[model samples]
Target chain A: MSQELYTNIAIFVLSILVGFEVISKIPSTLHTPMMSGANAIHGVVVVGTILIALEAHSVLFYVIAFIAVFLASINVSGGYVVTDRMLQMFSKPKKTDDQKQDGGDK
Target chain B: MYLVSAACYVIGLHMMRTPKTARNGNRVSAVGMIIAVIMTFLIVINKHEATMTGSIVLAAGLILGLAYGTIRARTVEMTDMPQLVSLFNAVGGGAAAAIGTFDYLSLTAGSHISFAFSFPVALDLVIGGVTFSGSLIATGKLAGNISGKPISFPGAKLLNAIVVIVIVAAVVLTIGFPVNAWWLVLTLVASLIFGILMTIPIGGADMPVVVSLLNAFTGLAVAMAGFVIDNQALIIAGALVGAAGTILTLQMAAAMNRSVMNIIAGGFGTGDSNSAAAD
Candidate 1:
């Protein structure tokens, strides 16, 4: 009912529209990398959640806070790992079969 | 302050929209961030007086985070960007969880209750906890830290169902008897464990979708936290994140030639197109 809730809802709605438009165009090949990049943005969420958790006075909030931290940590570490793996995939040499196929076409 | 955060979110959304002009997008977001940072500082100064522990800690945390984020931003390649994104998301979720816990302890100081703070606080814990664990598992799947293959065990779906049941029970307990804090704690723990198991079976290729979903969770958590604390800025920021994350999830799902329902229903499987498309 507060102004804050209204603003949050508005922003949330707007962002969803924007996110849909933006992510739709990303190439399939780049999906993983893009996702990894986007995950970093979750940092903002983590920070906000942390701030809120810190303010919690209830045991329920405390439990939620702990889980949030744990989940967020997994997110950060996993995203980093995936991005690195994908990059490694790019760096690796193409299979000899693929090279041979190219030569045969020529 | 809310305006500044909104602007940052707007610019960030703009950047996210125009990936081709990503550098420009980054700049726009950066400007927004600067504004947000200043607003945050101003708020701290205004609310807590000249010098307070919260202010000092906030300043220190911001500095450290900024330094770390900057370094990562500069060095991380576009190819590895998704992982970084996931990592950042985790940090956000973790921070949220931490803040909620601290707030609960501080506000209570001793025994008894406050209905005004109860609902929001509980919401923050559940959503934030899920986001934190879910994001991490998605990151692991994406990075190959966990197997890229879709991992499904006997009764995986059933287990998840049971976990959901437990979470619901916990929620009821939390609301029915706010005085009994232990139920709340149990719920969060169960949720965290559930999050890990939920994302673990998903394959690497499907990670983009998973990340998007987790991002949405994180955002919702933040928004809930804002409600708990009656902070406009936090609410706006959280909502922005949740909405964006959900959209991204949909996009990623589409990119995979799948639907969200199919992705989750299919569970984790090694179904590479080149190798098994014809199968």
Candidate 2:
């Protein structure tokens, strides 16, 4: 095997290990947001599509590449925006005046 | 440069374990994507491979996609997030398949593709095709466009088995006879059908696990495309997605008190009103 291929394999293996370890500790409540975040990260495939689009030669290829670019971009943008919206719901609730008075007594 | 982007992804993903930092992690990952995309564009420009027409097409696509995604993301109810995620998975998988298809066509037109290249191309086409159709079906179920019941007939398993066999055979044939584009097309078609059939029987409750599994399929397809294009960044990013998606799929399955294999084997809950009571 070529050195480049070997390096690629090493990166692939290490990333898998890291991915598993980093995500293992997440609480179940955060699963949906985590999935959304990971979905956005996979949108990095947009870069690959961009590279392919630049090299497209025919009208058919251009059309295909265009759709790919558009779709992957949606994955990136939509994934992030939705994830942000979801995470906002998990933020601390604002303290009302009544709650503040109660806390002061405590 | 890709290494930097990959590092950002790793750190960003790590930070996502907590709700307190998950949004920031998402932004950090998006920044990493921006860097990778800009770098790719710069490299393409430097190599003089980017055409004016291609650039125009890309820009148009990007604007349209950005507008649609932003609007949909903002407007979609939180309850519908799973459906949207399935749609995004479909798009990503389809794009990955398209990449492999274009590469295969060009390689065949010029010269014979090596085994290393041919294998990934075939794998990408199959996995991506399956993901494309499978995700759509998943989205349909979640969106109430299709019944969220287990729609299995007597020969459903047998048919799925046949389709799988045909896909594998077609891939093997295409690798041996790279000039025969028909075999490649057959493989793509079979896989697409298999994807639809596979997802239709899975109930609505299993949609989370199904979507997660499809997400992993898309990641694997992207990794295969990376091999086809010889891009290190794609490989690393795709691997991270695949691994993370698998863990998430398993976790979701566990949350629902189902095994991953049981989920794949057409899932529990027949969608009858009493199905939940029976469980």
Error of 2 at B63 (Å): 1.6
Off by over 4 Å in 1: A1-42, A45-106, B49-56, B76-79, B109-116, B268-279
Task: Estimate the TM-score for candidate 2.
Answer: 0.92
Task: Go through the candidates in order and give each one's C-alpha lDDT.
Answer: 0.59, 0.83
lDDT of 2 at B55: 89
lDDT of 1 by residue, B1-279 (tens): 457656765565555443343434444544554455456556644654432333334444445555566566557666656656766676666666555555555543335555446666667777767867877777676666877777777767678888889888887666556356576677678778787877777775667777778777777777777666666655665666676667667777876688887676566333433244466
Residue-wise C-alpha lDDT for candidate 2, range A12-75, written one tens digit per residue? 7888887788788678888878887888888888888889888888898799889988988888
Per-residue C-alpha lDDT of model 2 across residues B140-192, encoded as one tens digit per residue: 99999999877777667678889999998999987866456677789899999
Error of 1 at A98 (Å): 32
The regions of model 2 sitting more than 4 angstroms off are: A92-106, B268-279
Candidate 2 Cα lDDT to native? 0.83
lDDT of 2 at B126: 96
Name the lDDT value of residue B85 in candidate 1: 71
Q: What is the lDDT of residue B275 in candidate 1?
A: 48
Q: Show the lowest summed lDDT stretch of 10 residues, model 2 chain B.
A: B266-275
Which pairs of residues have clashing backbones in candidate 2? none
